[model samples]
Target: MVAKGFTVDLNKPLVFQVGHLGEDYEEWVHQPIVSKEGPRFFESDFWEFLTRTVWWAIPVIWLPVVVWFISMSVKMGHTVPDIVFHSGLRHICVTLMEYSYIVSFSYQTKSYWGNTMHYLLHGCHHKHPMDGLRLVFPPAATAVLLVPFWNLIKLLATPSTAPALFGGGLLGYVMYDCTHYYLHHGQPKKEVAKSLKKYHLNHHFRIQNMGFGITSSFWDRVFGTLPPQGKDVKAR
Candidate 1:
């Protein structure tokens, strides 16, 4: 369980009530709150609990879904290479899709267009970097997203490919969530873990716009958003 911390009133939109100092709202939101659990979001006890997620829940709930979808393709006679290629492709595509919702606005408009949505999505994580529950995507939200994606895959691909493709997507999501949690909380002895933690943390603390890649920096390098080398990067 995430360590107990201050709770916010869920009845009101969150960003407006807290941390929106008279100064710029954009700047305040990115100033990491640095607590295991940041202020709570819901007024009701049940919803407040549901919003925070445990890191292990990502694999526990989703791995079975991945297996089920991949199994469908296997039953349809899809070969190992076919599944592997499609799975990796699905992973890459999922990462790319994240680029859509990530935008920075100089003007804070949380009251109407920008407020509650940003807090529920990206801004909350930036503000509450240490909130373990909010670190990974909630399974409930993922399930809702999966329905359309599953149908879209069916619409686009043959029976042989669609299941594996969707399965790969589920796998990628699990990996992404797990990796994100580790990047925040795990101790890294290996070079790869050390590197990924640094890359992701830098995104949170130092350079907000760059280093968008979480599990790997390949995307950042390809897109030219990778944090520059040879500069002093201090952890706050």
Candidate 2:
């Protein structure tokens, strides 16, 4: 029987099972897979807990860094050419683009690496979509990605501008993670959120290849991954 988009495979031993690990360790380690579940991999509770619990502190951890960068830039009289941070519209646009880039990167990794990368970044979610404990981005994983991202941003822009851009991207990530959890667990009063939930759910159930965006569908539309025109959408 299928529960929350997963089915147990009787033919195979659960992933992460090793000889002589004992029943208690075995119970905690094994995760069953459904029809579309990707390859099974070992997961450590210590690491898993660290990732799941870090969500609450994300804003506190990153927002101050953004403020510091902007303030320091202003103090040092450093600014990006052709872009003024004072403009509300510009801030919004930059933040959105950065956020969209992360989503695009995720989709591209899945495409390039297939199930291996998907299992690392996204397929685990697809396998156990409703598991609230696993909803947020792991800090360990983020740190690995951010080091390279930080270097990339630094190369592209001035110090003053890079922080703000990075901060915006950070905020974008926060939004994406929050929105992803919400779509799975939130009931929205607004039509936009309702629509977003519908779009995301379709990605999970009806068409896994499409609708990669969580915070917004802008990238999905741009990348031609928008769900099919007549694809059935269900809200749950």
Candidate 3:
């Protein structure tokens, strides 16, 4: 049975605590709070700090790696134009596949969740919309996921070719992460960014199910998940 006044204890591992809610986590998590901070996933300060990251760190740590990956392709005699064309295509395909997964997962997320599973996946973003530290994917988690991804691309191409394609995809990931942070925190004076910010926030505050596309609403339109606009509506 759930405690009558259950609240998340942020200073400890969250998975066990959230699991205690069983099916109640879905409804409990959607309620938003405006704070610059987020839940601590671990009690140990060292481990807990790994759960958070700043917005600017994305480009600093990854852009050089992106350049290095593309350089490998150059060494194999691939021209700059060929690399750009193929890499750009690969980037687009990866993006489409990503948003497609987001759309599917958006609809299929059940009311019952795995303790802190939903929080880890996306619930925390909704619950604490203004928490800038948690706004982007932490580098630690990204590094972990890249291992299998690094290997997967190798199967589809020779050793010389796979890293170049992966580099394109890496660039796409970097762009996606950077853009997600901007949509939340960027104050746009121009109309286009203002509109994009409005659209992204709509998914957070107005309709969580729609606007699964974070970087642009183009895929949302393609997937038929765009918010209904009679009242104006709008993710990362």
Q: Rate the local accuracy (lDDT) of all candidates.
A: 0.75, 0.58, 0.76
- Model 3, poorest ten-residue lDDT window? 106-115
The candidate maximizing lDDT is: 3
**TM-scores of the models, in the order given:** 0.85, 0.67, 0.88
| Model 2 lowest lDDT segment of ten | 20-29
lDDT (10s digit) by residue, model 1, range 1-236: 11123334534646445443323445657778788867767667777777778999989999998988888888888888888999999988877665433434323653434555666677789888888888988888889999999999999999889998998988988888898888888888887788788888888888887888877877777778777874534322
1-236 per-residue lDDT for model 3 (tens digits):
24346766666666557756655666666667867777666668886687689988988988888899889988988888878986897789767966875655453233335545667767778878788888888888888888898889888877777767888988888888787788888877778887878887887788888888877788888878888974554323
| Model 2 C-alpha lDDT per residue in residues 1-236, reported as the tens digit of each score | 33334443534432322222232222212233333222334456664456353346666666676666556556666555422443233346644564454455344221223434444455456656766656677767777888887799789877766766666566666666777778887888898999989987777677666777777787677778777777656666
Question: Comparing 1 and 3 by TM-score, which wins?
Answer: 3
Q: What residue runs in model 2 are displaced by over 4 Å at the alpha carbon?
A: 1-44, 78-117
Q: List the residue pairs that clash in candidate 3.
A: 19-115, 199-234, 200-235
TM-score of 2: 0.67
Best by TM-score: 3
In model 2, how large is the Cα lDDT of residue 228? 73
lDDT of 2 at 5: 44
Assess candidate 1 and give its lDDT.
Answer: 0.75
Q: Once all C-alphas are superposed, what RMSD does model 2 give against the true structure?
A: 7.9
* Global Cα RMSD, each model: 5.3, 7.9, 3.0
